[model samples]
Target: MAKKANWKELMTLHLRAYIPALVAFLFLLPSPVFAAALSLSPTNASVRVGSTVTETVFVLSTDQAMNAISGTISFPPELLQVVSVSKAGSVLSLWVQDPTFSNADGTISFSGIVPNPGYTGSHGLTISIQFRGKRAGTAAISFSPSSQVLANDGNGTDILNDTNSATITVTSSASAPSTPPAPSTAEQGLLARIISSTHPDQTQWYNRPHAIFDWTNAQGVSGVRLGYDKDADGEPSVPYSEPLSHKELDLEDGIWYFHVQEKGSGGWGPISSYRVQIDTVPPLPSTVTFPQGTTTPSGSSITALFTTTDELSGIDHYQVAVDGKVFTVTADAGSRPYQVSAGPGAHMLLVQTYDKAGNFSTANGRFFVTGEASSFFDFFSFGWLAVNYISIFLIAFAILVTLLFAAWYIRTHFMAYRYRLNRQLGLTHAHVHKEFDTLKEAITEELLALEQTKSKRSLTREEERLIVRFKKLLDHAEQTIEKEIEDIQR
Candidate 1:
């Protein structure tokens, strides 16, 4: 009985080993009938804007049961925006390369929710160890196969392994710009002109509620667009009108340019351009009121006065000068007339007033400063007195002589100018000589024409005076020419 039992156990072991070997041969042998394969489902998955999408990566094999198989999906951050990741099952592990897959760990991982929520389309995560979703735009996520269970036949011979890959695309959700209707061109006979209250040029200051520019046209204007600019090249300020009109527009003081677009049934005509420059700077104080050549002392104080006003900024400060030196007034006195001090001897006293905006005006005048009494040597000697008297007379005489010479030179030069002008205008030299025959003739003809004519129906006095003065000027020229001819003959 023992011998029989041993033989039976041996026979059973042999049978077991032989049967597995036969199965292995059937699987591992070179047979055209059998093959191994692996693949993924939904290779190109897409998700809607602001939504989540889940896809299963299959490790499909011809064999019913395979072991030790793992897979991973990597997402490109540039392509898809990742929010979070989740993992499930002991067999699967999750890692994220914020680029392709979504997990806290910075690695290409699988077995978890990839790319946090709110990420959009085609997160094409490249094949890299550590992934940072740094790149953006249309991207893709590559699903790659990880090692799986190795399969063997009954004879312990390895049969095959499983592998697969896939890619997904993400789409964008931005909109496009509005399309404008096709533009048509036609002449609408529309005309625009600007009228102003102060300056017809419409670019200066005069009074409040100052009118700058106004336009009129024959045809009724339906709509208009108004555009303005400050600097020459910068983008224009935001356009002020959709349908512009004659409504009042308040403007500040500076260079300004304007353009208007008129709309009608015949389409919009070429834009009309107009400009206005408003200045609120108050005019400088007038009537500087200087004395007739007052002498300034060597170091004495001199004072001058002037009134000032500002339409916008109030007067801020004032300065007084003697030939532009020596401080005069240094205290603030509001809008009152201020005084400045200067040194003596025909000193030029100027009062410069400044507005809050740094606009300035100047008033010029003169002052005298006498030295302290009895500060000189020898008061009552005839010799000294005579010499002083002679010096005074000589100075006065020199000044008078200078004045006479200057007057003569000026008169002669002016006659020359008149002669030249008459000749250029095709008038005779004799006509030019009559204009400068005397001081009164010269003044009435050249300087006092407008004054003399202000009350007359026309410029009769001015015209008559100028004609006679011109004839005198021509006579002088003729005489000069005749003298030169006589010299040549001699």
Candidate 2:
């Protein structure tokens, strides 16, 4: 209209304007694809020569569900040697091919798949790899550009949008370089952030006598020293030379203070400290106090009380045993007294006390239990208790009777023989009897002296010799008298 236009030219202008608008509209539309990412944890690390460093591989499924992944990681073989690869707790449930690594090639490869439901997370751990620092240099742990992460979206489309690599610096010293190189501004910012990984945690209680101190490896660190003491009054004076994470330390029971500091080109950093308690000693030996007398009636129960003291960790529990069999174990603090029922005869009771540190002490006592019996033979049914007492009494009575008869017979026969011997040899019985009386008196005096001395002390050597000599004289006199009797009888 406005100039009745040239129709073809108007149409051309309209087409150009609409084409640009359509293109913009198409660009604004949302795409159906999603992006995923793979990364190595501890993007940077500092390790000492002859020591190992571990790095974990993680995956992020952004907004997509990933079903399968395959990747290769490469490192400089001359500077770092592969130690091991761990796939524990991986998200992938199935393996297309297990993770494999070669030290010669300085490469690691893994291929795995998840179930149909797939997995989506920000920190899906894939694997952890350990490497030994072989030389003093910098090494890069990188993923091959050809690595693939497939989405579960039917088409198996590669959704990997990015990959992250790790950098490690290996030093010659056990901790860090004696002379650290000038650090960048970023490293200077990290100096105050150094911390220990295996610090004695507030909730953890160590039972072993030895411990290992571990710490995070930071950049620009030249050396690390550990100072520890038994108290908290002042700074620790002891020094640990190495910064190795597996450094073994021997510690005893009680409270301890540990301070860790790092040295760099800028001098030593601030000391990081912690207070911890170590308990390794066991409680004192338990004491079992039984009733005054050992005897108890059959089918009756008796109680024994236990007492124990612990200085460091305190008592945790007690265990009781009767006749080599466990009777009961109790954790109640008030349950110190224990009781047991006996059938008959004898029983042995043992009690053990334990500390929180798993150390224990034991004490034991023996007792007898009497049984009821109606008749003499019924006593025999009570086993060793009644039978042993009866046998002992019988043996003692038999010995007494035999001694009485022998005494009578010896007195009569000896007097008759001696009468004949005295008449024939012109000897007097009063002379022999006086000698015997003197010998008996000497023996009695020695025994009295022994009893009067201190209970702990023994008889003197001279006193012992005197008693022996007196006994020999008595024996000789008896032999002389007997010989004369025998000769007279002949």
TM-scores for all candidates? Answer: 0.24, 0.36
List candidate 2 stretches off by more than 4 Å.
Answer: 1-24, 27-33, 174-176, 179-490
TM-score of 2: 0.36
RMSD of each: 44.0, 32.0
- The C-alpha local distance difference test score for the whole of candidate 2 amounts to 0.73
The reply for model 1, stretches above 4 Å from the true place, is 1-188, 202-212, 231-245, 281-368, 371-490
C-alpha RMSD between model 1 and the true structure: 44.0
Candidate number of the best TM-score: 2
Per-residue alpha-carbon lDDT of model 1 for 1-490, expressed as tens digits? 9999999999999999999999988888775432233344455554434333443444333432322223455555544544323222222222321223445432344322222221122221222221122332344555444423233232322223543444444434332222234344344354345455444554333333354455664365676656655322123233432444553567665444566666666756555655554445644474455332355455544334465444333455776566657453432552344444443344566677766445677777656665634434535455698899999999999999999999999999999987776555444334444543554366546545565565675666766676677668766766786575445434
- lDDT for each of the candidates? 0.48, 0.73
- True lDDT of residue 130, candidate 2: 74
For model 2, how many clashes?
A: 0
Clashing pairs in 2: none
